[model samples]
Target: MTITQKIKSLPLTFLLLFFTAVNIFGQKPNIVLIISDDHACQAISAYGSRLTQTPNIDRLAKEGAIFNNAYVTNSLCGPSRASILTGTYSNINGFKDNISYNFDFNQPSFVKALQAAGYQTAWIGKMHLGDSIPQGLDYYNILPGQGQYYNPDFIRSGNVQKRYTGYVTNIIEALSNEWLDHRDRQKPFCLIIGHKATHRVWMPDLEDLGSFDDKTFDLPHDFYDDYATRKAAAVQDMTIAKTMRMGHDLKMYDPADSATFEDNIKRMNADQKAKWFAYYAKIKKDLDAKRPEGRALTEWKYQRYLKDYLATAASMDRNIGKTLDYLDKNGLSKNTIVIYMSDQGFYMGEHGWFDKRFMYEESFRTPMVMRYPGVIKPGTAINDFIMNIDLAPTLIEAGKGQAPAPVQGRSFLPLLKNQHYTARDAMYYHYYENGEHSVSPHFGIRTKRYKLIRFYKRVESWELFDLQKDPHELHNIYDEPGSKPVIADLKAKLLKLITAYKDTEAAAIFARAI
Candidate 1:
């Protein structure tokens, strides 16, 4: 009750507080980064999409933090990945878009960073960052960018070239299992498990081809956005009506569709030409006898799309379960930090579009789930804005190490543990659409209530929407005089963000003009 009595208990009280904090935040948990290509958050069951079946992805959210507001700096494949790797934006890393260019892996990555921090690093499956896989990535079976879903060629460490005969998911899983079985167990491991699933021209294994044959997929509400105001949306290379390639995706060029073999052969050249003709010959012969009709036809394509995407994901989910089982079987789950995420969200018939590039809600949001054994209390949903670049700094900070220099993203370690933590006021987003495809360039910033977008080039326009009122982003508020003041404020913040992220193009142009 006296001052001396309180002073005598101070050391014990301090020791108890320190121990409690330490127990809540584990020291150096093994990090497992599971990234999927173009796997939209809408596809995962955890995000409340009832269409697809993804139990493993659901389990991660059930066990740890589910980041509802997770986003990517760049919505495309390569640039977003560059942001993920370096914890910086596309302009800073020089991988602004996906073109004939490749990402320079020589730069600092989370793999090299964790490896430096005494963790054994391995990258399995798709590393669509660039062709050249850097040296210190412990084990690699990466497919440069958008590797084949069937019979993919895997490049092992010993310069051995081997053609994997099974589906890509199966191959990736097998290789990852091998790496796990043989990896140095004494040290903490950082395994980067990437899946080349649910990308364009979706292909499925023969066994899974008839899985979703009976289900009729519900079309999205905005499946037919006329693009009258959003002209840039009309010029995309992935329009469902015509732009989606028939031969590659729609199966319109199958030999059965064409009466003669020569007509089928017209689209092919050399080996790829012959291979497609042969595959088409078999399927064509089957179709000629009895063409699929009415509900059968609808079911056929549904099966094609469903099995094609889900089969790949099925293998991935199984393999993820394998990894989790390994951690548990080996008594490592208690000390492991597992994260499952996608490069960016993809269109599942939304806006009648495919691929990721446009700054829509589906493409803009990515699936991000983290399970840090002792640190992150399970089932915490963080509604604040989080992005791709933040993953690295968060990992470094969680490992009881100081965050390195040149990280554009801030760590959300506080939000992970503290339920009452306040995160960023606004999340900045910018995606350049001039790449191999003719997707128009654009940039934007999103707040909880308002969104500001600026389309590039001739007669550039600004789009402002109060997201609270227009959650679907169907109506443009930028033109309305009532939203003008709000637009000005968000635009100023967007410009400030461009400067903060070292967006060189915006800097030079805006500075000289303003």
Candidate 2:
């Protein structure tokens, strides 16, 4: 029989069920995915932050689900973003590191799937995909590179560059709202708003310059780690004590260097420049008077770094609130699926490090929260193992489309419904960036209780941590007498995963480590 004839002949109860299924499956939800660069989970109050509070970000957790164990396939910026876009690992996507590569926008992505399925897609803010514009996007306005703190330049849809005249975070938020204003209301849309806040050389809005001045941040317990057992950790150069520069990172550039401060204030109009200099003059005066030395100097710089970082984060959180408020006031909250995440985890002075390249907990685990009013229960939290690669599959599933065969990620929709759902036995991570921060290229497997890493290339070494015993990863027990069986099992699993994922290059490298 024809579908129309069958529907007309069906009994009332049967007809209701048939139409209900169609309504439920046919009505795709609008998606708003907000990603910020180098934002550590520990920095968000929703994730139990100790440094600062993020009320707007916390709102997503209160209204939806929070994933506590979300990680990235690779911890660096470009690699992690590539993994998200392609739903595959860095090796599979072909953008393994932060330099000398362009993302092949021709690759099949979840965005393309959504577009094909009749959804309007838009990308705004710091995509960091590559030098060129990404394909499969209907509209986009992105920063040229890492992006500047104040008055950054953005490349719009036609490769036209426009310089915005405000704090980067605020400008990104405003542009997102503008895009939403002009978007077609009839079709379901997928919008990604990427913020450049909380990245390197953190710069706060002028109004937030002294926001954290009264509060003192406590140093991490392992701030003075000697790296006694791990040679890989000992030889790295990301430590804040020695590597964080005063001129570039901490904003203590010489006053006589007219160009340094001028570049920051150039984009500001008269009133804006006046306000900026007024706020900065006080900080410069304090530094000049103190002239802190020795451990005191390092501690002073740490405090300065934390203050600016948290202030920048505060501005980002405010913009998040603005976006959420827009959805609520416009009556788009019920059918829209809102998500807040970071490209990857960042180091927040944990282990006395300020950059993110290692396989440590701070850099490897990212923050993820989602709000889908009817489908997801409010105030829910899940501890399942999830990765950035899983995002593409999840979005595709949410949009009522199937993930393509080439995609390596699995959808976490089941876990959202039932937190105890078994997803994967372990997660894999590989960092291929060589010597940018003096960190060795490495690959590892992280199970529920153990983490095994092989730091190769410049150094052939192994490190194993029993997370149940040492959450801080202070001691590497790779050479401990009783660890032979555990190490053997992890190594076998690692090899199997490497081969299964078609990471042929990594497999060859793993053979040498074994």
Candidate 3:
């Protein structure tokens, strides 16, 4: 071939290379979000937990990145979910708590953004926001309210209610795979798989029942916390000894005696009901024989709680493995981004508590592990402080689209890619519901070394903890000597964050305090 002939073919060669590059780098990636209820980091082995092994959840960290400082704007389930979707705080999003507030679907959401970008979206499992599906999602089959562990009822895409005859965790996993199999193959997709495991009334699958019966858990170091100077922690009702009931929570009561137990038993099929009753009958008999009193009774309750919770979590972990396997078998593993997280952290016998509400480190810091092949390097540990609100923008960016105008969280895509990024020095948290658990309404800021919290509404008091000195937050050194400067700095940062977030009510509280 002559020089002129070679020059004539150069244009076609360049065009071919351009198309290949677009296919390799410019294509949008699929997103898989697996969210669990009340899954504490302390119960997961990936976080160095002594309670249980969570290989499936840990796989995400092994393959991609594990975040050490991931937190939630609000630590309640519904509000955290709302913040994750809208990229805003509870005050801005208007879903402040589980009971009193309804999610405002009018706001911009990440799902809507993904839909606009020609991606199909579906949410299956526990979306406790409402009975009706939110506006942004293309399809859904969500559980109504806090879904049952056995034979749960799911509200489908057209408001059709159907009872699935299986464990809630397994049912959600099956539904997720079903959606994946039937999704529009031409377009990318985002699937949120919500599991109702490790929630209150921890009921494991029939096969998983008594799986942890032999393991004895040591009590948390601060299990007998006297609350000391922490006024808000003292008045609270969330406790393993008092708040957790034998009937409703532990399944150690006769069905006729407890309406919650009766209601739950009625939902299970005959075989499931029989297995559940048989397993608990042994526990009830053992309890009656021992008749544990005083500290013995409390210790028994703690053991039962941990065993049941860890057993329930076992089913969730197995189901997670199934979902990961589905992606692998379908050749979607490479182009798909898989994220495993909880709505918020829960107390696994931390500070003598079973629920999550306070802004302490245990409840405030949620677990988050994200796997994005080729983008996030394997075994990367990110120490940057990121809140749940950041999920919306990060997912939107992954779909190759922009977040909505109202979204507040800046995308953490740069951090995932190991690019130049600015890390947040402090993160803000607020809990609004003073209804359940008697936790006072509070807003606070957590820096790297110090945490400053102010409890208001029912109890107006300030508590400050030097996390470096007291990781468990046992000592409230708000009035300790030599702490004035530190308190002033934290307050300044907290006020700045409140103003930046446009939280007028918090600003008013700050002004009143000053």
Most TM-score-accurate candidate: 3
Tens-digit per-residue lDDT, 87-199, candidate 3: 99999998989888888787899999999998999999998996545787889999989888888899988889999898889999999999999999999999999889878
Give the TM-score comparing model 2 with the true structure, all chains together: 0.93
* Candidate 3 accuracy as TM-score: 0.95
Worst 10 residues of 3 by lDDT: 254-263
Q: For candidate 1, lDDT tens digit of each residue in 1-514?
A: 9977875667887868766667634446778888888887777888887677878877888888889999998898788878887888887777877765678877776666777788788888887776675654877777646777666777767656677665777778778778888989877788888888767666554445545545667767776777656666666767555455435564546545553243223423355545545654555466657787754554444435544566556666766777777778876777788999999988776776667776778888999988876667778787888989999888876665555577788888877767455677787777775643467677888888988877676325667777899787788877677987897788789888887887878655444421
User: How well does model 3 score by local distance difference test?
Assistant: 0.90
lDDT per prediction?
Answer: 0.73, 0.87, 0.90
Off by over 4 Å in 1: 1-27, 252-307, 419-422, 435-437, 509-514
Off by over 4 Å in 3: 1-24, 259-261
Candidate order (lDDT): 3, 2, 1
Runs in model 2 deviating more than 4 A are: 1-26, 258-270, 419-421
Top candidate by lDDT: 3
Q: Write the per-residue lDDT of candidate 2 for residues 446-484, one digit (tens) a residue.
A: 999999999987667999999999999998999999999
| Higher-TM-score candidate of 2 and 3 | 3
Worst 10 residues of 2 by lDDT: 253-262
Cα RMSD for predicted model 3: 3.1
